[model samples]
Target: MQTTFENPRYPFKHHSDLNQGTAVHHPVVIVGAGPTGLAMGLDLAMQGIPSVILDDNNTVSVGSRAICFAKRTLEILNRYRCVSPMLEKGVTWKKGKVFFQQDLVYEFDLLPEKKHKLPAFINLQQYYLEQYLVEFIDTQQQVDLRWLNRVTEVTPGVKGNRLKVETPEGSYVLTCDYMLVADGANSPIRKQLGLESRGQVFKDRFLIADVLMQAEFPTERWFWFDPPFHPNQSALLHRQADDVWRIDLQLGWDADPQREVLEANIRPRLEAMLGEDVDFQLEWASVYTFQCRKLDSFIHDRVIFLGDAAHQVSPFGARGANGAIQSVDNLGWKLASVLKQQGPTTLLKTYDIERQMAADENILNSTRATDFITPKNKISRVFRDATLQLAKDYEFARTLVNSGRLSTPARYLDSPLNTLDDEEAFDGGVAPGSAALDAPIIIGDKTSWLIDILGTRFTLLIAIDKTDISRVGESLPELLQSVGVDLVPIFLFSESTDLEVPKGAMCICDPWGYVAQRYQLEPGTCYLFRPDQVVAGRWREFTSDSLISAVNRALGFDMEVMP
Candidate 1:
């Protein structure tokens, strides 16, 4: 359990490194036990994998940075069973208000429908999110968290990866099968890799103050643009759970100075917003700039980039934490498959394509939100203000601006993981990720369908209707396993629906189970999804011998078994 031992190869072994010396070997070594790193470690632990989470910070940031939670992120947290506490400690906002020049401009309510049995959005501080995750990680015996252990350098070794880390006790080396770098925008690991960050950096800086106000502010988020009080400044007042307000002021590029802008200007703006003499104890305040940048690739040999280390979105649409979680979810399963030796090595390349596209889309969303706030030129400013004002009269225009489609999960369309033909192709429709694909059908049950049927291995979903269950069950499992395959058979029970009789069909259902893949009651038809959720291979009217051959092809194995 003690991770300190002397290793001469450590790059930082001169001064502070002498105090600490440990040697550690882990399946996955993660840097920065922040929200992104903790989420990755939690997921890997759930899959029975061991992970070491190391962070240089002595403690989690007490100030609120990212507060809004998207629908996708909530769904992920639910899987780890951490959503309940998060929802309890966080403020849930169903409505938002936007204003201009001290007048009501537009207001909109979040999606009220229970689309996926989760709320639309929740606003909680980033620190609480990390704390809840740390608690959950402590409960898992397989997850190990090491605070104040800073990852100094990462070198891609011939066989695996070599990581140099420094702790209060001393310094040591951590060799791992894979390294996840999540050390934020100024990531030293990324710098060591020499990966260049590409994007535009706006000159404007905003002052953010997290304070508890005596007077009441509406729970809904309120935004102002060029108000009469401060015509040159745009302000945002976000209502937190503990009667706290996170206020952001758009200070001009050439402000007096950073501290002056905060203590002298930001405090007064908050006092004015309250509209009366009120005591506001400022907890934390600082000036931060926005940048729209992304890395060229997320994968570089044994090391993969994650969170702000991979890309940065301006804090407009609140997409940073949500996007980072998605990146981890995308990479988690692929890493598992590669380590388990069940999938091809090339599947790892798809992580870059899928996550980069998602990050690029987030950049666009943040850029658009930034433009709407501080338009580039006079012409754009006029257009943006007019649109916000017109939103009061027109419902359609307001909905367009409020959709937040950029926060949605990135689809795996062009990746080799997708095997849909013209008929089964995604017609601009959302497809479940590998984890959600072929999830068990939970009809009239409170539990998720996939929870019961999906073992910790490959499975086959069979929608059997009057088919021979005994012959299919006994022969298929043995036949598949003989050819280096692990298949679990699942049956779909639907009495009234009309289904054609196909020999082998894999039933695919929507997340809500409206309708999707269907096949007849024939016993020989088969459909397969890779561990990562992409359809690997499909077959119809095949014998036991022939089906084994198909499974082998999907696994990219040439070994022939005595079927």
Candidate 2:
């Protein structure tokens, strides 16, 4: 049961604040060097915003924590230029199997559609992901990743938040216009400010065993409910990089977490699952109980919370890190706009509103999945088993078979930033507030996925379909330019080279008709996407007045999209 991994440790350097004998001010500072904190810092750096990241640890995550990275997460990482290693090193899969008592009842495909730029999910160790982010950050001049630096105290004020950061050399005073609290669920900053993440902490316990070995298992998610090896319990199996397999087995509420993680007890469980003759080495072991919780508000004065510091969910749905990455994606551009004074401070309120709504959705899904996996009562167990028994034969039953509701990009349908469509007859699934979908697009002589270029800016995804692209785009460029707008950039998309758009617009050709078919494009149709790549507004007919209003509304310039 002996296995080891190469965990890189970073060396600490003395900051000038330790000897400056006075407080130093920065635009932004992030606490914790985990995936969330590192992502926040890296995100700002991508936008040319400098940030200081302080962490007490010198190394990345120790174990294969958060092995599942969702498609949305990869896209976000792609923007920061850190997803290449992850795609190269991780195991990508889109199919999943659900088993009832060792019998494969049914299997499902996450991405039934084709021509996607990224896979549905990837399984890689958290440490590997962090290492890649750190390596990429080292190349960017805007990030100051301080190892062994800890935040001993947080003082929030109206203008800025003050932090007392402790380092190996000494403690120093640091202040920032904004303090991003990504310090994790047990956040020191949260406690220092008397904030609480209120939600139910489930009583059931589970053990995670990272097994290392060469095996013939396919790269797919395999879940078992009441299997012979673990009767009356639920188990999950996932293949990770480096011949590591993650197995999660439920141990009742009364199980001894300490004794269960010991090799003596863990080995027997492993044997039961993979026959006694199979060979495997234990890479790591840990026990945990999950919670579906979030802070009352992710924004507290000048302090903002992201990742685990803002919300948490059970691992059953792979919502933890994926949701956290999405949170930062949603916050990064909005925060950058405010920091650069391109938008009002009130725009930050939308982050709290939109992210809290998303947190509720994830928590609800995670709680439901956990409940089905571990039935609370005999009645619930009977119902679950009945649904599982009928799942293979009856298609309707499959919908009720809740192995785990997989994570997807959150749709902020009710977000205040959205301008609800006035035309109800038009439909293509790319409605206002829907997460942007990716499709193969033809640009000039080259071909690329639509998502590769869409998420980073405010886009006017106007489909040509033979319409005059220039007429469709109109004076919208001048409208944005005349608003004294340098913070937000917009791009125009068309189905042909017919985009005689403004000189300011970067035109993209979608000649393959893939993007048109997906978006249900017709003549003179235009969709406005926010900086986070969420559909802010869509119209069956394009007009400069309407597009301008939508753009102003999206940038938090005006309250509504006028007719």
lDDT digits (tens) for residues 16-105 of candidate 2:
778888889999999888899999998887666999999999999888889999999898888777888999999999999999997889
Best by TM-score: 2
- Candidate 2 lands at a TM-score of 0.96
Where model 2 places Cα greater than 4 Å from the true spot, the runs are 465-467, 470-477, 483-501, 558-563
Q: Whole-model lDDT for model 2 versus the true structure?
A: 0.84
Candidate 1 local Cα displacement, residue 486, angstroms = 6.3
Candidate models: Cα lDDT each: 0.66, 0.84
What candidate 1 gets wrong by more than 4 Å, as runs, is 1-24, 214-218, 399-406, 423-429, 432-563
Tens digit of lDDT per residue, candidate 1, span 1-563? Answer: 11111111212123322344555568888888778999999877756678888887656655778888876687677767788888998887767777778778777666644333566678888877887888788799878787777878787964689888766666788789888888898888888878898998977788887777655666777778888766856887787756667788787777655564456666677677665578767766778887999889888888888999999988777789999987877777667766778666666676787787778779888877776677778897777777777877888767544323326555655554543333443332223223343233443333344433333345565544445545565565456557564565544544333333233323333334432332222334444544433344444443576556555554434423101
The true-versus-predicted C-alpha distance at residue 91 of model 2, in Å, is 0.2
| Predicted model with the maximum lDDT | 2
Residue 353, model 2: Cα distance from true site in angstroms: 0.7
